[model samples]
Target: MTANVNIAIKHTSLLISGALLGLLHAGLANASGYPVTVQSCDRQVTFDHAPKAAVSNDVNLTEMMLALGLQDHMAGFTGVSGWKTLDPTLRNGIGELKELSPKYPSKEVLLGADADFYFAGWNYGMRVGGGVTPDTLAPLGIKVYELTESCIHIMDKPKVSMDDLYIDLLNLGRIFDKEEQAQSLVKGYQEDLTNFQANLTPLKTIPKVFVYDSGEEQPFTSGRYGMPTALIEAAGGKNIVDDVQKSWTQIGWEAVIDRAPEFIIIVNYGDVTAEQKINFLRSNPAFKNIPAVKNNHFVILEYIEATPGPRNINAIKRLAEAFRTAL
Candidate 1:
C-alpha cells in the first residue's frame, strides 16, 4: 500500500476509536446514580434501572403512573372497567394502551405481558393471600410496589391523609425516573389545596359528613383510615364515622342516624348507580330523622375521586363547595 493510504487508514481508525470512547463516557454519565431504593409499604424495593414494562392495577394507581408521563413504560393496566366505568379524562390520559384485565389479573397475565414491575395494593388488585402478590410475583422476576394508602391493610399506618397520595407519587417518580414531574405535580396540588382552604369561611360548626359507598342491608362507609375521611376533613367537614377505626367498612343505619350527618357524599361506582343509593336513602323512613336525609343534602363523588389519586384535589374542591351551598 502507498504511504499516504497507510497514513489515512491509521487516522480513520484513531477517529473511530475516539468516537466509541466518547459514546461510552456519555453512557456512563447518564447511568450515574442509578440503583435507587424506595419504600413500598413494608418493603424496601431497589430499582437497578427504570422499568421498561410496568403494569399498574386499578384506575387510581394507573392514573398515578400516567401522571408521571410513564405511560410508555406500562405494558397495560388492570382492575378498572370491571367495576367503575372510566371517566373521559382518565380515558384520554391513558391514550391507546389496552386494559390487560378488566379485573385483577392472574399471574399468567403479567407473565404474558413480560411485565417487569407491578403497581398494586391490598384488595386493590391482590388480596392478602391472593394468587397475585409481591411474594408470588417476585419469583417470576416481577417487582411489586404497594400503594401507600392501602398499606394500612397489612401494616400499621398513620391516619389517612393527602400525604398518602403524595407519597405514592413521589415513590413512583423515583422508581420511574420522573422525580421532577412528580415533585411539580405534588407542589401544584398542595398549592391549590392551600389556596382553596385560605378562602374558606371559618366554620363555627364544621359540617358532619357521611360517605355512602355501597350496601343494602348494611351501609358501607368511610372511617378514620379511609381516603374520604381525609378529604372530608380537608373540605372543612368531619366524617361522622371517623370513630369507626377502620378504613372502609359496613355499619348499621343506627350508627349513621345517631351521628346525624349534615351532608352525605355518595360514592358513584359498581352496578348500583349513585342516584339509586341516594334514592334509597331519601325514601327510607328509618333514616328520615337524619339531618342529611331530612334536608336532602347530598353530593356524588366518582369512585376515582373517593379513592387516592389525582382526582382527590378536585374532589376536595367539590366537597368544599357542596358543604358551603348545602348549609
Candidate 2:
C-alpha cells in the first residue's frame, strides 16, 4: 500500500471511543443485531449469528474484511497470489491466514476449507452461470455477500459511484456484526473525500482520460459502469469510454484514436509491468499523435486502488494531483 492509504482504521479521531469501543469485540456481537438480514444484490440474505468461519476472495474484498478487523472471523482468503503480489501492508494483515487457492476456487476447494461464509462477487471469484455463485453455494450451507460493484455482470444496475464502495462496507459490517467499525470507516472516507474535493484546485476543464487495464490487440478497461469511472470523475477527469453501457470490456484501438484522450490511467497488475505498458503506448507508431502519448501524461493506479478497496480514497488523491500536474 502507498503511504497515503491506510489499510486499517488509522484515523483514531474518526472512530468511536469510551464504552462504544467495547462493541468492536466478539463479546458484543449481538449488539449490532442477530438474525439480521441485509440486501445482497438481488436477494435478502439473513445471518442468524455473526459468521464464525468466513472466506473472502480477491485482494479488494479481502482488504475490506481485514479493514473491519474481521481476520479473526476468517478461516482463510483466496484469489490473490495468482495475479497480484501482496504488498507489505497486505502481508501484515493476510500473511497469517491460509490462502485456500491462488485464483478462483472450485466448489471442492471452497468446500474443503469448511467456510461458512463466502465474501465474493461476480467474476471476482464466482462467475455468472459458473460453478460458484450464491445459488450453487446455498445448498452447501455457505452464505455469500456479492460485491456491489460486481453486480453489473448479472443485472442492469446503477452507474458506478463511490456509494457502491460504501454500500459494500456498510453491508459487510451488518453481516459480520461490526457496525461501529464499518460506520467509522465509512464516515471517515466520506468526510475525507468531501474535504479533499472541496480543497482541490479548480480545473479549467475536465481532461478526457483512458484506462489501460491490460490488452494489446484490444484494450480492456472500465466503461460507464466500472469502478474507475467513478474514480476518474472523483479525480476531476472523465473516462473516455464512459459512454459504453458495459462495465469492464474490450474496445477497438480505432475507438481510442477517435476519442483521443489527453491523459491515461494505467491499471498496473497481471503479467505485464506498468513500465512495459507505457513503452507500448510510447513506441507504437499508431499512437504517435495522441495527446497523452505525446505529452507523456499518465498515472499508474494499482489494481487494488483502481478496483473497490480502502486504497480508493488515496487513489483519487493521487489522480487529482497527477491531473493537476499534467495540466
Candidate 3:
C-alpha cells in the first residue's frame, strides 16, 4: 500500500509538472508580442514587432513613414513617381536610396539584408510577383504590413478620407512605438485643416471641378470613393466624376464636356511634366474647348500628393487655398 501511495503521488506530480510547462509556454507566447492578426483587404498579415528594417513599395507608405518620424527605419524604397511635388529633402532622400524592384527581393537578397519587416502600399507586390509570398517570408521570420487603403475587396469600396490618413499615421505610430510623435503630428494636421476651413470665405457656390490623372488610352478619373473626392470636397469644389463608384474610372471626353467643370486639375505621373499635360490638352481637339481650358483655370498636382496618404491633407489645403485665390 505504501508503494502504491508513492506511485500515486509521483503521477500527480508529473501531471502538475506538465500543466506548469504548458502554462509557462502560453505565457511566453503571450509575452513575445506576436502581432494581433487583422484582416486587410484580401489577406491576413502578422506584424510581429516594431519594424526595424523596412521597405516601402508605395509612395504613400514612404510619405507616411516620413511623417511618423520613422524614416530612419527604412531599408530600401520603391515608387518614386509620387514625390514630384514633395519637399526637396524627401525627394532627394528617395533619390539617394537604391531603386527597389517593382517586385519583392529574392530570398538570397532578402536574407542578406536581414530586414525585420516589410511594409507595402499594396499586397500584389508580395503575393504575385517574385517568390516573396507570405509563406516564403514567414519561414525566415519576416512580417509584412499592407496598407488598409490598399485592401479594397475587404472593405466595401473604402473611401479615402483625411480621417483614414490620420488613422494610418496612428497605426504606424502604434506599430513603431512612436505614439506620442504620431499624435503630435496628427494634432498639428488637424489644427491646420480646421484653421484653413474656418478662415476661408464662405463659398457662395462650390465650383465644379475635374481631376485628370493619367490617360492616353483610357483617361483615369477619380470616383466617389478615394483621394480625388476627398481632394475635391476639401478644395471647396465639387467632383464632376463623383457619381463613379470606383476609385478610378474611365470616361469619354463627351462626359467631361457635358459636366463642364469650372476648374481642372492635371496630375503628372513619372517622367510626365505639367507642361506636357497642358500641351496635350491644348492640342487635343476634344479638350481644348473646355471652359477650364478657355478660362486658364487648370492646376497641376503631382501624382504622389493625389494618392491616399498623409500628404493628401496638405494637397487639399493647398488646392483649396489656390481655388479661393482664383475665385
Candidate No. with top lDDT? 2
Write down the lDDT of every candidate, Cα atoms only. 0.83, 0.84, 0.64
Candidate 1 accuracy as TM-score: 0.89
Better of 1 and 3 by lDDT: 1
Error of 2 at 147 (Å): 0.4
lDDT tens digits, residue span 127-220, model 2: 8899999999999999999998888888888778777787788778878878878978977898998778766776767788999998999999
Residue 236 displacement in candidate 3 (angstroms): 1.3
In model 1, the number of clashes is 0
Supply the global lDDT for candidate 3: 0.64
Report the lDDT tens digits of candidate 1 across residue range 1-327.
233333332332222233223323333343445776777889989899999999999999999898889989999999998997987888999998889999999999999999999999988999998999999999999999998778888999877877788778777777877766776787788778777776665455678899999997999888989999888877777889888878888999888888899999999999999999999998889999999989989989999999999999899889888887776
Candidate order, lDDT descending: 2, 1, 3
List candidate 3 stretches off by more than 4 Å: 1-39, 42-48, 81-87, 91-97, 102-112, 123-140
TM-score of each: 0.89, 0.90, 0.77
lDDT of 3 at 211: 84
After superposition, candidate 2 runs with Cα above 4 Å error = 1-32
